[model samples]
Target: MTDVSSPIDTRWFYALVIAGICLNATGLFTPILEPDGALYACIAKTMAQTGDFVNLYAVGRDWLDKPHFPFWVTAVSYLIFGVNTFAYKFPALLFFLGGVIYTYHFVRLSYSWLTAQVASLILLTAFHGVLSNSDVRAEPYLTLLVIGPVYHFYRVFLGARFYHIVLGAFLTGCALMTKGLFVLVPIGAGLVLHWMLTNNWRELLKLRWYVAVVLSFVFTMPEIYCLYKQFDLHPEKVVFDNTNVSGIRFFFWDSQFGRFFNTGPIKGAGDKFFFVHTLLWAFLPWSLPLYIGVGNVVRSIVKRIEVPEYISLGSGLATFLMFSLSGFQLPHYLNIVFPFYAVIAAQFLVRLKPTALRRWTIAQTVIGVLLVVLIVGVLVVVQPARQGIALSLSMLIAVATFVFFRNTTLLSLVGRMVGAMLLLACMLNLFLYPTFMNYEAGLAAARYVNEQPQRAKRITALYGPSTFGESSWSYEFYVDGPTQYVRDDSVLQQLAGQRSVQVFTTNIYADSLQSRGFDVSPVAVFPYFHISQLTGDFLNYKTRTSTLKPYVLVDVRK
Candidate 1:
């Protein structure tokens, strides 16, 4: 393995570390966006308030989509820090930090400290990593869970203590609880492939491996019991258009494989190359290097070249292929495997040939410059005056750092790339999201209603065709008090007898309410973007207005 060990500039490295932390931390202060972030926060809040840890409820109905571990963690955070955005995201951020630490250690053990630092920085500064922190979802928890067991099991394979195997099993179980049995594909594949490739097949037949499996099964009992009590015990309950759905069956098979085969109740239009393209943007700045690194690993394996470590390449490729073949997929699903990608890229960087290192440095520098330009362009378009000073200062720091490190070695080039991403993420967290969320009509309308003294006492009704959209969920979560849903426009007269009431509906329905002789005064108007269907046109300022429909909040009285 090629090693590029040189004296590190401690100050520069520490500055980058601090910048990464600050960038991620700023995301906590931003309002949780719809529909997942707000929905998950409300679920956690409900869990804390009602003390019902077993069954998940949303909008006063049974919710059975995800496992309970993330909610449990967030509910605990709510208890400690109160039900706020920061508290909801606090635990996930901590777990992300833990993933960072573990990634560093795992790479260091397998390679060197320099590679570890690069890998950890890559994980921290990745665009999706920052976005996931603010969005606050299962991915943050799963990222840490996936890395922890892999690290421990790798230690076990390295002839560490038996306790390492036990710990690895426990983490594996926790990961299974987070995402389901598919969590094993990456870690298990990595370890087994490593042993197989290294001709250490005896390690696979060890007694401790069986013990680890038992411990993993034991740790998973909590999730199984919760599923059994919630769904299995109540066969009369309707879920997924079925009279009686087996929760354990759903947990074990349907949730993972059903989705893979597109036979699940919840399905998405899957593309075979969905993740292949997603990483291009999600891993931004580092994506090029990652692809190159992964290609090198594959080539070396094919040619029977001596490999540094199989764990990263083995696990990353396995998971990548699994998701590639799965019938349903999302970009965030790729977040769990990113730690492995980081290690692979970092190891490649450390061992890169001098000519290849120079080429990578040039490519990264070009990307860094382009990103900085993009940030400037966004600032010009958005003109975040509220955060002007902070944004300007961050930009200055980033520019200064790049200039100072100009013409340095390969490490400095990596720093420049990371610094550029950090600056962009900081601006995104501190400026763009805060301004953009104002257009999140649901939360905005909720706040508007809460601010009125008389409005607070009035009954709030949300009128829409369906109850399963970002607007409904965001409004439900942010509205201070109970909100009733009127699913049909024909039932508008039913609410006419109410003395005081407010209704949130789209402009499409506002005409119907107004024509019905009910006094309707438009309180707030916002451009609505469905959170799940965010496309480039929807996000661009130039094209956003054309893509959005008007969502209106109105005061309606008899």
Candidate 2:
């Protein structure tokens, strides 16, 4: 085995880095998943179409759930690339990659070059990291925005340059715009806890800290102004079923604290251990190592041992604890702090003793093998139409893992495990997603509608008793011409008299409409499911049909 202190060959390191990136990028061409990705895409499409970047609108109504940074960026991409799924996702992927770059440089500053490389790879291949790049949500933007500031702020702490503070503040503002004020939790915790642990708490009172605060607010003016224009100026505007809501207030307080306290218009049931168990799956391949590394750091601190740096530990663990205690929790929220986890885990692996290294080596190898088994199981059970190409790719990855990492060194084992993850990701992106997206049904319906002449094809989606609100934002975004969502028969009757209208609705709803003396002719039938929320019944080919509901795109006439 190679010495623990030795740096990996640059050639191998770069190859692994490239592989990690390619894995994340694999889903670039895959269809956007529903409920979030498509919803965001449609909102961006509305922004691009209207050329109004200030107000965020979804389904032709004001959207107050999130800040507008991601939408603004995506809107610009839609303007440039023309509102396709790639356009919606490309900018987000770039931001996530930017986060990866920052992670590398941050660790290089805190530790060694070898640690930096490993950390960046760990950040990239971490399950949620890869998933977020594909899912393409606020996390990608927050990941970059949050880490970019920390890197600059950490440099500022070391007396690097005045520009570091300026850049850090700018990023802080961007992070605020991305996910609201809760972003400050990790950034503040990192800087504050590091200073206290390292006996540099006096730096907290420096004049520069005050300058940063002012600059952060200065940079945040655009969001503040936009929110003020959209809601604050018009106090009569209804939002969240309340007419007196203020956008600026929501951006600063309600958007974050409301959710934390379960007092928001939107709320969720929180589990104190939600993130803990979530990390078990979401961190994947490296979750066990990360837990051990974090525990070791805490033990060292308790024993009064001198440690290398506390920034990663402070930021990662602090944010983790805060999320665990919040009234609302989600899997992707952890993606923001994954860079810190990568750095923490990487440093721990670099300093491992011979005995401990062997145990981890064995444990990680088992994990790698299991990941391979998982992909193989998916291929077998799903039996995608493109199974041949997917299997070929999986086998090719297996061969590469064996040939490149056959030695007994820790780096080689790491390479093999990463290969396992790469193999699984490739299967999911290239094979599984494309196949399952057919069941997304909305995209297929949209494609069908788009193929028809656009002269008189006004689209309307109906909702009624039998259907539990199955509508596709992907369809709304992709369909040519105007789309309306109507719930009443009178609204449909009025629309049918006004134009040649096509309604995308459930079979049961159409049947009821027909019996009520409305003219409905079936144009196409689509198999539908909420692809993001997968279930075992949906996965098993035998029970898949029962799990699917039928949605019909029909031409309605008065």
Number of the top-ranking candidate, with TM-score as the measure? 2
Error of 2 at 179 (Å): 0.1
Count backbone clashes in candidate 1: 0
Alpha-carbon local distance difference test for all models: 0.81, 0.84
Model 1, position 535, has a per-residue lDDT of 63
Model 1 agreement with the true structure over 206-253: per-residue lDDT tens digits: 888889889998999999999999889999988987868889999989
Residue pairs with backbone atoms closer than 3 Å in model 1 (clashes): none
How would you encode candidate 2's per-residue C-alpha lDDT over 9-39 as one tens digit per residue? 8999989988888998888888888878888
The candidate maximizing lDDT is: 2
Model 2 residue runs over 4 Å out of place are 1-4, 454-457, 461-470
Clash number for every model? 0, 0
Per-prediction TM-score: 0.93, 0.96
Weakest lDDT window of 10 consecutive positions for candidate 2: 462-471
